[model samples]
Target: MSTQVAPTSGSPSRMAQLRQVFFSSPIVAFASLMLLLIVLAAIFAPWVSPYDPTRLAPATRLKPPSELNWLGTDAFGRDLFSRVVYGARISLVVGVGAAVAAVLLGLAVGLIAGFFRALDAILMRVVDGLMAIPNILLAIAIVALSGASLWTVLIAITIPEVPRVVRLVRSVVLSAREEPYVEAAMAAGSSTWRILTRHLLPNTVAPLIVQGTYICASAILIEAILSFLGAGISPETPTWGNIMAEGRIYFQINPGIIFWPGLVLSVTILSINLVGDAVRDALDPRMAKRGIDR
Candidate 1:
């Protein structure tokens, strides 16, 4: 006779459990709210920004914060507030793009490396080599060779992160491959791809979600660093890093030039990281047992 399993909770729905956990954690709640605001601002930059981010007004250069200028003007007399808002959009695009691409590539490689004993040594050696090199140096070399563009920057960021995701997924696959269900699937004439996809893939999803948030945060910081070094997006662009780079020369005239954009960049990264932490706690079985997370 067949049997069915009941839900984990008799009263609270899964969404309710998650909501309870969210409201109970003040730091996570605040971080989530901040992340939401930053995302919304980035998405609505065209409507939210008062001036063309790239438009220059030479006469008003280095203007201080005011009712008219909002966050004030930069060295080039472009609107700082407008540039910051628009910058968020591009920064997020790079962050999310790198996270997704890295995860996909890593998932494929990690599955093969973990499942097939013959390929493990070769794949791991390549991954270890990539990990041995400093990510920033590797990224800079790529940007220098490829020339700066959105696509190039995305590729540079994604390459450095792939090893991390690959390691995470590979470990999960290795452990899961020994499970009874997986062994049974193999014995029952399941294809290697079928066993990997149907049995192993589900185990990685929760961890991948947590890891993706961290990758997004790291990519944002790396992009900013590259831009600050004049190796990322064009100087003409209004990314937070580019803004700070341009203002460094005239910092005495207006510290606000760099300060405001830097603040926004820092807050966005902090929010993403905190959210990732919250997700990790939520997905952990121990935390779930205590009703501390979903």
Candidate 2:
């Protein structure tokens, strides 16, 4: 005969569950710490930066990392460290702004398409058309048409991401709408709005959240690419992309110019991806069940 384990008050609280999920994967913990430090550095840039990122000094131009200038001065003699810090602000803003916009728009489209069978084909066809175009190329076209600026770049990045998000949400909603609870609500004469909002929307949150993190990470990388290609924010702006663009000319002279900012960007993206993976594993019921079994 087998003995059964009893549920008890010792079971973890919501916060404890989240903590455990975050720490269950060592990569997630390290990534979280790295992201936290980067965010803090970005937030405190104005105070922590030794010098103005954009203020140029010809006398100090091309200076290597030194006591006076931590990451050294760029070709324009602007502080590399300061520029990287300020660039973080731009990247994070674009990433988060684009992700939020895409998720909101995608959720609406997905809900309508998935809930109403009549609209599914047409809506999904449109989503398919959008997805057919390469993401970066679409963003470039949008940015080219709109003219490059912070907002334009954000919109450009967001538009390309929406289709992917919509597909993800639509698939989830399609499966969820057939569930017993959803059918029960439908048979009980629940209003379409109530059924969609009360039942369908809640189920999409976990996957949408996971997708959003990935979108945020993608947006950041896309923004950098756009800026580097001269299709992003103004060159005068001290974004990581523009900084690297400027640094490329002097790479033979001082590789540090490109190295530092590139390192930060890579680290930031990696950290976000790590956290996204952790969140996906945590929110997935199969994964959680497996963990419990283990």
Candidate 3:
């Protein structure tokens, strides 16, 4: 006679699993660290920056990197290091804010479209029309019409992002809505809202989270592009793109002006992209299991 052994639970807590996945790959760990440092620098810019980001010193114009000014001064004689530090705040705000707005709006549209056959055709046609337009072109048109400002730029960027998110969520919901549990919930006299929230919405979270990171990264890049093209926030605002735009004029004289901010922007985007990849892998059961088996 053989004695039966009870199966032990091996599943890890969410936080623990996330931590493990973050450190599983060295690139992911490094990216996360770099991203964290940039965020911290942005948050403490007012206190930690050596000089005022916007304050001009005509006497110090075009100065190179030195002990007095670590990253040197721009054409306006404002500290390059300080401007770059402060610029992080704008990038993060736009990226996060636009992504959140897009996701929430998309989620609502997607839920409605996926759940109801009548609305699906109408909503999908609208989504398709939006998708047909080039994202940057649409954003540029909106900004041009609305006049350039941070909020306008944010709205412009978000509008283009909504279609992609809506498509993703609608697909997920369409698939989930047909599942036995969801059908059972519907058949049991559950309200449409109740079935959506309880049965369909939860199924969309993982993919939405992954999609959100990509949206955030894309939003940051789009904001920078708009600013560079003079269609973003005010020129007076010391954003990364504005810094580069200002620096381009004096490119021959001092490349550091563009180099430093460009470097920061590139790294920040890369970090966000890397984190998104890690999150995708972590949230996917098949990917997680494959990683463990390997």
Ranking of candidates on lDDT, top first: 3, 1, 2
For residues 127-176, what per-residue lDDT tens digits would candidate 1 score against the true structure? 99999999899999999999999899999999999999999999999999
**Whole-model Cα lDDT of every candidate shown, in order:** 0.91, 0.90, 0.92
- Tens digits of lDDT, candidate 3, 136-240: 999999999999988899999999999999999999999998899988987899998899898899988999999999999999999999999998999889999
Q: What TM-score, over all chains together, does every model reach?
A: 0.96, 0.94, 0.95
lDDT winner between 2 and 3, please give it. Answer: 3
lDDT of 1: 0.91
Report the lDDT tens digits of candidate 2 across residue range 169-230.
89989999999999999999999999999999999998998999999999999999989888
Cα lDDT for residue 54, model 3? 87
Best-first order by TM-score: 1, 3, 2
Model 2 vs truth, CA RMSD: 4.2
